[model samples]
Target: MKVLTETWWSAAIGREKTVTVVLPPSYSPVGGPFPVLYLLHGFGGNRNTWLQCANLSAVVDSHRLVLVLPESGRAWFINDARGRRYEDYLVHEVVDHVDAAFNTVPTRDGRAVGGFSMGGAAALYQALLHGDRFSVVASNGGAFEAPLREGDPYEALRGDRNLAIPSTRDHERVWGPAGSEVRRRYDPYSLIRNRDPRHPIEVYLDIGLDDYPRMISMNRRTRDALTAGSVPHEYRERPGGHDWDFVDAGLRDLFAFTQGHLLSA
Candidate 1:
């Protein structure tokens, strides 16, 4: 297996965004291209989260697929109206650059995206909103619709002065606006509501039964919505909590499922 670290830059962010790309044992530029998985990191994490926190390279190399881990910081993988075009930076800039520079198969079928926590939600949003660009998506313990709920942790980071929780609106401010419509756009629950039931993308989601209570409720609601809409998906709940231990344990199952679908692509 070959691991390339911090090789690409993101022009949209105007800074050096670190990334880790892993190539399978037989990877060769002259021989052929391989399917790619864009792995996103959670809040307070960098590109190395997958490598250091979980053994993704070992898992992917065993299957002979390419994996790319991109750093999005705490931006939640969304383009803020405040001027950060992170969504553009990721789907357009990063995907285009990687396909051109590496022996990566650039097609909806050849691509898959997933993440944990905030990153998981981002992956879901990316796949849902841009279904034509991705064939598979998975979210492990993601804040699927946390952006729409009260007492969001992000509010503590925003430092906004006008919000109801002025002292704790800082994080929300950083994410920009708090209107119902804007919140709905980021909320996965709303995505399922607005989109067609037969959306082509395949989605996988699971959160520990003992994690955040609010998120647990939201995931149930999300499952209900999917069922009501007849949207096909995979959902699982197990004994764990919201932490790296639970995520690392969950990765094997999630990766196995993703590998099967992504390889078929």
Candidate 2:
């Protein structure tokens, strides 16, 4: 596999952004375009998270797919009410820049998106909102439910039983003050409920049984919502937790599902 770290100016955010791209082993300028998969990192994670935590090199090499990891910081991959247009930056600027700079299949049928935790929520929201841009979407240990209460914003960052160290304050910046209309607009549950049934994108949802209780509950609720909407999807619960091990294992299945839809399309 070939790895390239690149930066470009994003008009949406009015700043330069960085991204890491992984090309298949057989990639060549003359090899024609290949399908693309955008793998988003979770809260407090950077573009290198996937390469560091998952066996993505092997997966990309085996599948001959191009992978992209974009830096979203704690933006939650959404256009914040506070004036940050991360969602626009990602969908309009990043995607367009990648297609222009690389040998990628520049169509919805050849593109897929997946992520873990916060990133997973972003992936699903983006796919659902812009079905014309993504053919398949997958989530692992996604925090799908909104923080309805004022105190729930810090719950995940605090970790189970308040064991994990917390550093940044993201909730208000991304989703607006808790329980606000802005927050509800970006909530995955709300988005799913309001999704257009006719423009269904192929969905994959997986969460660890041992993951944080909140995460598991959110994923379950997301699955139930999809079922109620009669949206076709693959949902699974396995023995694991919200960690690299769980993400690595889930990625294998995600890649397989993505390949089936992206390559065959």
Candidate 3:
């Protein structure tokens, strides 16, 4: 596998952005094309977080797919009603740029998205709002339901003026007076709450049984909602916590589930 780092200024975010790309082992000139997986990281993480923490390239290389990890700071993959058109950035800017530049199969059936923690929410938000563009999505301990608390950590970060994050908080910086309709639009649980999930997308989520007390209730609520909505999904809880060990082990199952679906598709 080959890893590359690149940057481009995003008009949607009104600033430059960075991303890490992992090329498959069979990325040769004669190879026809490869599917793409857009991976995302949680709050307070950057493009390199997945490669550094998850070892994703090593795990998925056998499939010979391209992985793109974009750095959106802590935007939560939503266009803030106050500012910053982030939803456009991911669906339009980043996806367009990557598809045009790489030998990727640019279609809904050939694409997938997944993320950890805050990133998990972002992945689900992107796939849910743009289900026609992604065939599958996975959320690992992601805050799928607006976090069930007012002023989430991202909101608290928005409140602090002097503390500058590394990648740049476009949502907070661009959308002053954060937490509004924009945030709600990206809430996965809200999208699935009362809606019919006959949508053409498959979803999966998992949280460590020992991670948080709320996880059990949250998963149960989400599963019930999906069941009622007729949304096809897979939900599970295993022994572990919020640490990387749990996430890494869970990823094996995630990749396996996704692989099965992709093949059957």
Candidate 4:
């Protein structure tokens, strides 16, 4: 396995951002470009979070895919109301750089996105909105549902749930007001309800039994919504909490689920 960092100027976020990449053991240009998994961290984490927390390199060495972790700080991996277009920065700018410099498959069939908590939700959000860019999505202990109180923004799109924002309250700063267009745009539930079928995405999500009740309910809600929408997906429950121990325990399953779905590069 090999680890490296790549940095470049992002027009979307209008600044230079860095990402951590883990190359599979068999990595080599002559061996052909490898599939890529764009991994994300939890809230307040950076590119190094996964490595520091989990034995990521050892777990993924046999998977034969490249793992890319983006450095999105407390941004919920969405375009922030504070004028940061993290969504654009990730799907476009960072991807473009990785494809050019690294030997990656660079297409929907060979690409997938996943993450921890905030990152996990972001993975689903990015895939749901830009299905053209990825074919598989995975989340572990993900914050699928936003923490909204009574009388949040009502959904402009179809769904029983509403995500509106009245002010910049914590994550709402990144996701926008509860039901703002921006907020609705990133809501995985609403997006799944109105998913574009042309993409044919495969999804996987799991939550630890000991995780917060809100997280459990949100994951279940997401699973139910996927089932209702007839989207190809899998959901699981494990005995752990919202910590790296849980994430590390499931890395194999996550990689296998992703590997089983991605087309050969």
The lDDT values for all models are 0.73, 0.78, 0.70, 0.82
Q: Which ten residues in a row have the lowest lDDT in candidate 2?
A: 162-171
> Which is the winner by TM-score between candidate 3 and candidate 4?
4
**Any runs in candidate 1 off by more than 4 Å, and if so which?**
6-9, 152-167, 196-199, 263-265
| lDDT tens digits, residue span 1-265, model 2 | 7889889878888888899998878776665688888988887788998988657767787885788999777666778767888888878887888888888888888888888887888888888888778878888887666434344545545645623212335465566666766677766767777887656688898999887777788788889988887777899999888876888877678888888888531
Candidate number with the higher lDDT (2 or 4): 4
- Please list the Cα RMSD from the true structure of every candidate, rounded to 1 decimal place: 4.6, 2.6, 4.7, 5.9
- Model 2 scores what on Cα lDDT? 0.78
Q: lDDT, candidate 1, residue 6?
A: 51
TM-score per prediction, in order, is 0.86, 0.90, 0.82, 0.90
Question: Worst lDDT window (10 residues) for model 1?
Answer: 161-170
lDDT of 1 by residue, 155-255 (tens): 44356442222222534643545664446667776776676434477778898988767668777777787777666679999988777777787777777
> How well does candidate 4 score on lDDT at residue 243?
78
lDDT of prediction 3: 0.70
* Predicted candidate 4, C-alpha RMSD: 5.9
Task: Give a tens-digit lDDT track for model 3, residues 42-86.
Answer: 766788877765656667776656788887676656676456676
Considering every candidate listed, which one attains the maximal lDDT?
A: 4
For model 3, state the Cα shift of residue 98 in Å. 1.3
Off by over 4 Å in 3: 151-179, 193-199, 263-265
